[model samples]
Target: MSAVMITRKVRKWEKLPGKNTFCCDGRVMMARQKGVFYLTLFLIVGTCSLFFAFECPYLAVHLSPTIPVFAIVLFLFVLAMLLRTSFSDPGVLPRALQEEATFIEMEIEAANGNVPAGQRPPPRIRNVQINNQIVKLKYCYTCKIFRPPRASHCSICDNCVDRFDHHCPWVGNCVGKRNYRYFYLFTLSLSLLTIYIFTFDIVHVVMRSVDNGFLNTLKETPGTVLEVLVCFFTLWSVVGLTGFHTYLLSLNQTTNEDIKGSWSGKNRVQNPYSHKNIIKNCCEVLCGPTYPSVLDRRGLTQEDLPVPVASAAPSSSSSSSSPVPQTTHAVLCLQKTKAPLIPNKRTPDDAKPSIAASAQKSPSPKEENPPAPKAPPLASPEMDVETSINKDKTH
Candidate 1:
């Protein structure tokens, strides 16, 4: 229950309810924290409208034309958006898991120098490219390596993300490797909240317009100015975001995906997530426990891997398979061989060489050996010399 303990625990699939399934797609939740203001505003509108309906017959009669229907519709719309945020394909787990290995590889490359054991060299980023454009890709000076597409660094969290998504201020956390699902739900709920409140305000405005002359309506309605302002803000934001998200979703992409030119026609074949039944594949990603690697090894049960197309067969130049190898055994072998020795833990079978290296650094009797002198230590040069001189004088 403690914060430290909570941090240590990996939330369980079932017990960890409330957007536990989707962690990779940060924007799935949308803008829950930033847009919560509209939810509050809508609640106020609903409350006030109800009050007027009961207290003042004239006001109620005028407001009745639009208030109830508007309130109900708006409420439902907001509710739908909130609910949509929570729903996602649980099937993407396999793909996500597969990509995780590559991410780990990148981390490994960063840690140990590139040089092999006993060599004077270190491993370096082999190839680097920056597109020619005024909009320079944000660089990570700390990591000192060009990030792959969809990757970014969060200033607040101080870690580079694989796919940079918008930051949510409400959670006071970045929707990074761990917390993406919660963020998606947050945005979905907020959009609904905005739509609902906007609807309610619109109805209330219309009803007021009918009750009083158009010019007088402004004076008659309570909080008319506030209502108008909130309504404009909500409609503009919700409409714009919903439209943009629809396009991204249809293309089987996230905000990060869209920005990185992952869908650019020039490299369409190279995009790992591209394939037929993409919607189904993406749904699985959102809902499933295991995710595919970027290499497209289906993380689901073996039965779930997509069958290749026969008629729409890729051109001989294109392979329908993932751009990366399913499992890079070569890299794995190198990693196994290169693992660092941890103190106090039993050395792994692969780390025998590392242990031997340490052993070689210690002093041994053979290494300490020195040439022996022929004479004994007590047989000093001074004694020998004095004896020889006394012998000569005696003679």
Candidate 2:
């Protein structure tokens, strides 16, 4: 059937003998590693800028004091833009999501009325309260078991992902358990770099204000004006971006979720990915040891699981729509029924009657004759009666 295969309760990070690493070969790790390359570029630009602006007076005549700052800012902005692009189109990876199971339940529905003895029904997703907050859970259809919070099926990767974040093209990987914090850090640092450069150049330009006289004197200042243009552009971008990320951080959202339109009224309370403590969560996701691992995961128990008893068959308290073990919702489904096909018969209204007979039967409208007009009255004495009588006599 080309159905995927899965190993239950086995995590993504567990080490088997002779394996080199316990990780998805996805780009999240690689892109995060590449961020260092950008950092190095920033440093090199900073050195050059400093030498031109301060150390070398000869170059200072051509470059502004904030040139180094401008360079750093420009580099950061380009890096951020590239990263954003990368995040937008992440490639595929080979991995499976994992979660802990605390309870078990099973239900079955016949496929084409051919029942398999003791075969479990398909898994359903559910919502549950964890540590006083609601998080979603799901069943892994391939594994025939329920999965825990933050688990997802990666179609490209062809398996469920634990703590699943969206795939990013910039990192060329899925932003899940591990590289989430690094993603945030990359955005923040880029924003700061842009703002710093913008502020410095703006101040410098204003200080060097020239008299217009009869011509625009600002053009007299020498060399490439790219620095000024770059500064203004970065200023607008950084200010807007910083404001946006601050809000997302407060609400604990990813760029991927923001664009994917996943937020709901219940997101604040029901979101499993929100930081338990904003600061602590950021630390864990960014630079801490808390990346999502298939191994060492936890999940919900069976006693609290909600089983959707069929309304038609209420005595079967655990119906085919029972929630998966670690998840919080039922996998709702419609029962399939096949009815015998019957050919449609034409009614009197639908039948084609004689068109000529219908046309001849229609009533015709009757025509009425018009009445003749009355003659005009003769000319009176109050008018020019003599002239009227003369004219009538001539006629």
Candidate 3:
């Protein structure tokens, strides 16, 4: 008899190590480490920005005295927004909500009926019907909940973030529901600052060239050159980011949802979330509406989204039908089932009738047979005989 290894599938809702807590402690620690890097960058950028705006001789000589003050104030505002975006909690699901989800999950599981001990529960697909159309929402096994529309599990943060944009390594945080407005503001402000600095640098350089020869201007105003180069290099990313967010705001879409192609289909030219008014969509994102508030504004509830439903029961004409493909989770569960310990001694011809009989049997919810015990690999007669011989020799 070959050894059978039976491994049970761990349900996501079940309390497990590293998953039971609302906040993943390890991820928090890593975020803190990344925070330090971002802070360092911010400080360095701030120092350079201030120095070039005020201390650079060409800028001081040519630019109006009020320009530096305006630039500094704008720079500070940008920094403040950046800090808020980086440190603010990015809409982690509340403990109360988690409890609610768990309760709902239990009810769903019960309604589906108890799965046999060795078998996996069928995949529960949840969906919402809107205007006679079905929209699907993904389930996160790690969070043990169906993610809301526009929400996604950030692998870096190890949390499901509502209205997830993307994790900004430069900001050292996720731009999500609560802080996306701040993130957008930060990007916009930074872009304006770069353009402001770049503009003044160009003016200073041009003025200096007319007064002092071009080569002499370059040599004399090296700080101006450095500032120009820095702003020039960084402007594209800052401007592009701001522009991309603007487009997203106009359409009322998150970076994740947009990239996943969830909003586009043959049935509609515009996404449901898009309010049809660009100004209204922009206000919704920039004003920092809560998830429920956003949902309410759109006349939707959390449950309004679609999720995968549990598969229908097999039909009575079982023997004639082809087998359905199993879900990923179910396939994994089937793969982990224990092998029969005692090899079938019966010939293939003898086993054919039994296989056919089992196939003909219809599945029933009322059936509750306990899983049979798996035999150990050592239970084979040859292994047993060898074990006995070895014991006798030792004695």
Candidate 4:
């Protein structure tokens, strides 16, 4: 009878070691650390609540009724964009499976003359031409593959993301190929919403101040005052972020690429991804076909299932009769070892001591060990007797 292997049936998300939090049984996902994101949510919700409570009523009653409706519409849009940016997959490139990783390693070795594992490895990089220009793709140790062009590893997420822009704590998610558009839209709408609320609050104040003096108007509705104060401080940062991302969007460049100056003047590089036309760039990024999430997080995994003994075992006469070895998953682990301190080849100075030690251990042909000195011939028994007699006479 053949031995059997029993294992748990689990979802893919259950097995991943990523630093992400999943909810709704793997339907929702986000970074595990969300202190900043919680703060962001509080600020947005609180500010909107204050606006709807204190300012919207006065503006709707005094001015056109549509003022409140417009604000509501814009507010919902902003919230939707924010949530989309936060929850959607940010173009994560899944780590290579065992078979794929092994194949890549073999290809790298073969291309680089099969360098010895104990010796220095060849640079894990490959160059590919894109849009009539060359770009270097680097190997990611964590992903165990040459990173796709523009893709980078996020230390925070502990995952390699395709066309990575940046990790945004504000959204509690990464901005990358998948969600960059949503992130940009969120920032843009958030800044606009702040400005809209701030401007109307002032108008509401002015309208009331005409009937009552300015100081008296401030004293009557203090929530309006507080809303203005909150919006005042938050306005600049959100506006600035929006402006910067607009520039990036027009150029078809990521925040990561911009910060690194990848396609900048001194580097003498050009962005291959750029359409070289503003409208095209905007349309391509915003309206491009969306890709499905590569990580099948919700999918079930079945592995290492044992075969029935009768089916698995062959005839006793057959030497090849054997069930497939029990399977095990291979996980890519982070390295803790430091690089070598010295070069592989030894220098003359380094070799001198070894050479001297070798010389001392081995004798020269001319300095072979000499034979032991011969002992003086022993006296015969008669000579010994004569010597004994002479000794007696002398005594």
lDDT of 1 by residue, 194-272 (tens): 5654555556566667757666866665565565576566657656765675555445556765665655757453444
Q: Identify the superior model by lDDT, candidate 1 or candidate 3.
A: 3
Model 2: weakest 10-residue lDDT segment is 333-342
| TM-score for candidate 1 | 0.40
RMSD for all candidates, in order, please. 28.2, 28.4, 26.6, 26.8
What does candidate 3's lDDT look like per residue over 251-279, in tens digits?
88888877767767555545767777999
| Cα lDDT over the full model 2 | 0.47
Cα-lDDT of candidate 4: 0.85
Which has the better TM-score: candidate 1, or candidate 2? 2
* Global CA lDDT computed for model 3: 0.67
TM-score of each candidate? Answer: 0.40, 0.42, 0.59, 0.73
Question: Which ranking of candidates, highest lDDT first?
Answer: 4, 3, 1, 2
Q: Per model, how many backbone clashes are there?
A: 39, 20, 9, 0
lDDT of 4 by residue, 32-106 (tens): 778898899998888888889988888888888898898888899999998898888898888889999999988
Indicate the TM-score of model 3.
Answer: 0.59
- What ranges in model 3 sit over 4 Å off? 1-63, 95-105, 113-122, 129-133, 266-270, 288-395
lDDT of each: 0.48, 0.47, 0.67, 0.85
Residue 193 shift from truth in candidate 3, angstroms: 0.6
Pairs that collide in candidate 4 are: none
lDDT of 4 at 254: 90
